[model samples]
Target chain A: MSIGQETVLEANEARVVYNEDSDNPVEAVRSISLDLRKGEVLALVGPSGCGKTTLFNAIAGLIPLQGGRVSVGGIEVEKASGHVGYMLQKDLLLPWRSVIDNVTLGLEVRGKPKGEAKKIAQELIERYGLGGFEHSKPSGLSGGMRQRVALMRTLAFEPEVILLDEPFSALDFQTRILLQSDVKRIIREEGKSVILITHDIGEAISMANRIVVLTNRPATVKTVHEVPWGDEVTDPVAVRDRPEYQEMFSTIWQELELTNGQQGKTMKGAA
Target chain B: MAMATDIGEAKKQTAAPPAPKRRPRNSTGRLRIMAYQVAVLIAIVAVWQIGLWTGTLKPYVYGTPWGVMQAFAEQIANGTLLRHFWVTGQEVIIGFVIGCSLGSLCGLMLWLSPLWAKILHPYMIALNGVPKIALAPLIIVWFGLGMESKIAIAAIITFIVAFLQAYKGTQEVDQDLIRLMKSLGATQWQTFRKIVMPGSVPWIVSALRLNVGFALIGAVVGEYISAEEGLGYMVYYAGQLYDLDSVWVGIFSLMFMALILEAVVARIEKMLDMEK
Candidate 1:
C-alpha cells in the first residue's frame, strides 16, 4: 500500500434513501466513504442485501446520493460520466446485436463515428480472444463467454475507473474461478483502477489490493484490510497460494457474521 | 484463499459442439392426416349433393355445390366478380395501411411522457370499448356512400387494436435495459431508438396480424350498410334476388382475400425477423 499513489476516485459521506418522499423512508446507505488509488483494485465485500448495490449505484451515478458526494479523478461523478465504465451482474447485452455491435455500444452512445467505433471494437474483440465471434448474438454464447464479452465492452471505452457489480456471481463455480483470474490479469495489464463489489470473501482476498468490509443496510464501511501481496503479485491464482490468504479470508468472514448478528439484535429489539 | 487448495485444479476441457437438431420428417404421418382431412371434406360434400338430388334439402334455400360453382363461372365470364373483388381489395389495402401506421406511431410516441400516457389511458379504453361496427352508418354519412366510407370504417376498426397492443409493448420493455443505456451515457432518444423500439417490434407485428381480420371486417360491414361495389354489396344484391349460389360465391371470395392478406403479413414478419 503506497500512500504516495494518486487517488483516482473518492466518495465522502455518501448516503442513499429509497422512497425518500414516503412516510416510511428506507435508508439504504448511511455516511459511507472510501478512496481508490490509481491502478489499484479495491473490493467492497459485505453480507447479502447489505445495500452494497445501492452504494455501487451511487458511485456509478445511476442514482443520486441523498447526501455527500462521489467524484472520479477530481471531477464530480455526474460530470465525470464517461470516465467510469460499469459492468453489471447480468451481461445485459442487446440480444439483437452482434458481438462487435454489443462491444461498441458505449462508444456509439458517446457519439463516436460508426467506422471508428467498429475499428476500436474489432481490435478489442481480437485482443480478447473473441475474434471469430464478431457476428454471433449474445444468446448463442455460454455464460463465461458472455461475461468476458461484457468486460471487453467496458474496456473498449478505456475509462480511467471501472465498476464491477457482482460480475461473476451468475457463473458456475469453476467458471467463476477461471474468470476471476482472467479478469484480474486483464485489469492489471490495462492499468485501470477498479471497484469490485462481491459477497465472496475468497474472491475479495484473491483480487483486491485492499478490501473494504461493509455492514448491513444503512451500509457504512466497517473495516478495511490491505492485502499482503499488494501489486507485487498480479495473478489471482498466485494470490490464493499465499499463506496469509486463508487468514485474511476467515477474518473477513467473521466480520461479515458480526454484521448479521447486529442486524438480528436490531430485529429482536423491534419485535 | 489458500484453504481452497483445489479451486483451479480442474483440467482444461473444451465442451463438445451441440448436436445438430434433426427436423422431424414425418411425411408418412402427415400424409395419413391429410388423407383423413380430405375424406371428411368429401363426405360432407357428397352428403350435401345427395340430399339435394333426393329432395331431402330444399334447393331454393340450400343451393347445390354445382350450382354455386356455376355461379362463380358465370360471374368470371361477365367480369362482374373481378371488378367487385378489386374494389374490396383496394379498400382493405388502403385502410389497413393508414390505420396501422397512424396507430402504431401514436402508441409508441406515448412512451415519451408518463403523464401524457396516464391522462389519455381511460379515454383510449373507453373508445376501444365502443363497438366499431355500430359506427358504420355514421361513418357512411360522414365519408359518403362510396368506397371512402368503407375505407374509413376499416381504418377505424383496425386502429384501436394496433394502438393498444403497441402501447402495452412500449410499457413492457425491460427497465434494466434502459438503466444500462443511461449508464453508458446514452441520451433519452438513444434509449428509445436502441432499446424501446426494437423491444416493441414483436408486439407491433402481432398487432398487424390481428388487425388483418379487423380490416376485412370493417370493409365488409361498411359495404353492408351502403355501397355500389365490393364483395359485401355483391352478397347483399344476391340475397335480395334470392340468388343463394351467388351469395356463396361472394362469401368464399372474401375468405380467399383473408388468406392472401394473412400470407402477406407473414412474409413481412419474416423480413423483419431477418433484420434481427
Candidate 2:
C-alpha cells in the first residue's frame, strides 16, 4: 500500500507515564516509535490502560510526552494546527445545539465565519446521511446517528490526520459493525490518514492496514501485524461475516489473551 | 444477569402474550394512599381549629389558618403587599441573575485557566466558609440599608454556590471530547465554548436553582438586619408587634416564591434533558 506522504505523522522513542496522588507514577507506554503515513490506517489495540490512549494523547498534545518526540506532517506535535481530527467514544454533542451546529463546532471554533462553515457542515451531514438530522438535538438521535454527527464534527476541520479513540466501542455489535463501515468509507472518501484505537482485534483487522498491539501498562509494542485484508472498498461488516474474518479474530484474540494473562500482574509492579 | 437469561428463556417459552390481559392492581392502593394524605391534613387543621376555639393556644404564639389567610387578604387589599413583594422579589431576581452569571463566569474562567483556578480555589473555599449571614451586617454597612445591600448579600450567597458547581462540572469534562476539540486545533476559549460550557450546563443550572434559594435567604436575612421594606422586614416587625398572622403571611409568601423558583429551575432541567 502506498501512503500519500512518507511520514505524515511520526513518533520517535515516545514514552508516557501517569502519576496519581503519589510520587510513584505508572509508565503507561514505554518507548513507542511508529510512523503514520498519509491516507493509511493504523490501529492500536491492547488491554485497558495499556497506553494506547496515552499515545494518542501524546500525539495530539493533550498530554506531555515523558520521553521522545512526535511530529505531524513535518510539524512538531505541539504545533500541529488543524492537522488531526479526533472521534471520541461517547460522541459528546452539545445538547442545546442542533446537529448542524454540533458538526460545525470545530470550524466555528477555528473562526470559519458561521455561514460558510455551516454550509460545509450541512453538506457533510447530508452527504453522510444526516440531512434531516441537521436541526435535531443529540437527544433526538439514535446512537448510530449521534456517532455520525460526531464523525462529521471531527471532519469539519479537514484535518490532515485523524484519530479515532474507539469511536464504535459504545455501540452494540450490529450498529458497531455498520458504523465501522460508514466511518471507513467516509475517511477513505475524504482521503484522510487515520489512527484507530480499539481493544477489538476484529475491528483492527477489518479497518486498519497496520495493527499495533501493546502489552499491559508500562507498555511497549508487543507486536505489529501488517494485516492484508483483501480489498479497501469491500464492506467491513460483510468482511466480518466471512470465515476468513473469524480466523483473524481468533488468532488476534489468542495473542491478546496470552499477553494479558501473563503480564496482567506485572503492570502494578511497573507502576 | 440471571434475570436477562430468564427473560430470554421466557421469550422462547412463549412467542407472544395476550395483550396484557391484566392491568396493574395498585389503583385501589393508590387511592388509599391519597385518602391517608387527606386524612392527615384534615387532622392537623382540626387540631389547630380546636386549639383556637378552646383557647388552648395563645394568639401570639402561632396564627390559625383562618387568621393567616385574613392577614394575607388584608395586606393584598391595602396594596402594601405589592410594595413588599416588589422589594423582596427585586432582591431575589437581581441577586439570582447577577450571582449565577458571575459564578458561572468565574467557574468557566477557572476551568479555562488552571493557574487562576489554583490561585482562587482556596480563597473561594475560605470565602464559602466565612458565613454570609455574618457578612449581612457588613453588606449593609458597605452598601447601606437599601436594596443594594440586600442585593449584594444575596448575589454573594448565590454566586458561591454556582461557582463551586460549575468548577466541579468543568473538571468532570470528558477527556475524549477535549481530545476531539484539540485535534481540530481549537484554542482554549473555543474548547470551553464548544466542549466545557455545554458539558457544564446541567451543573450550572443545578447551581442556579440552589443559589436561588440562597439568594432569597441572603436578601431576607440582609433585610432582617436593616430594611424599611420587603417581606423580611414585615415579618420581623410583625414579630416585634406580636402579630403572628402577618408573620405567617410573609413566611408563606417567601415559601411560595421559592416554589416558583424551584418550578422554573425544574422546567429548565427538563428542557435541557430533552434537548440532550
Query: By summed lDDT, which 10 consecutive residues of candidate 2 chain A come out lowest?
Result: A226-235
TM-scores, in order shown? 0.89, 0.82
Off by over 4 Å in 1: A1-4, B1-62, B240-242
Put down candidate 2 lDDT per residue, B135-164, tens digits, no spaces. Answer: 788889999989999999999877877777
Candidate 1: tens digits of C-alpha lDDT, residues B1-276: 121112112211111212333544798987988899999989988999999989999889988899999999999999999999999999998999998888888878888877887787667666666777888888999999999999998898777767766766777677777777777778888888888888888778878988888899999988888899999999998999999999999999999999999999988877876676
Put down candidate 2 lDDT per residue, A66-147, tens digits, no spaces. Answer: 7889988788877436667777788888777899988888888778998999899989987998878788878879999999
User: Candidate 2 at B189: error in angstroms?
Assistant: 1.6
Cα shift from native, residue B276, model 2 (Å): 7.2
lDDT of 1 at B37: 90
Number of the top candidate by lDDT? 1
RMSD versus native structure for model 2 = 9.2
**C-alpha lDDT (0 to 100) for residue B134 of candidate 1:** 86
For candidate 2, the docking band is acceptable
User: Model 2 lDDT vs. the true structure?
Assistant: 0.80
Candidate 1 displacement at residue B176 in angstroms: 1.3
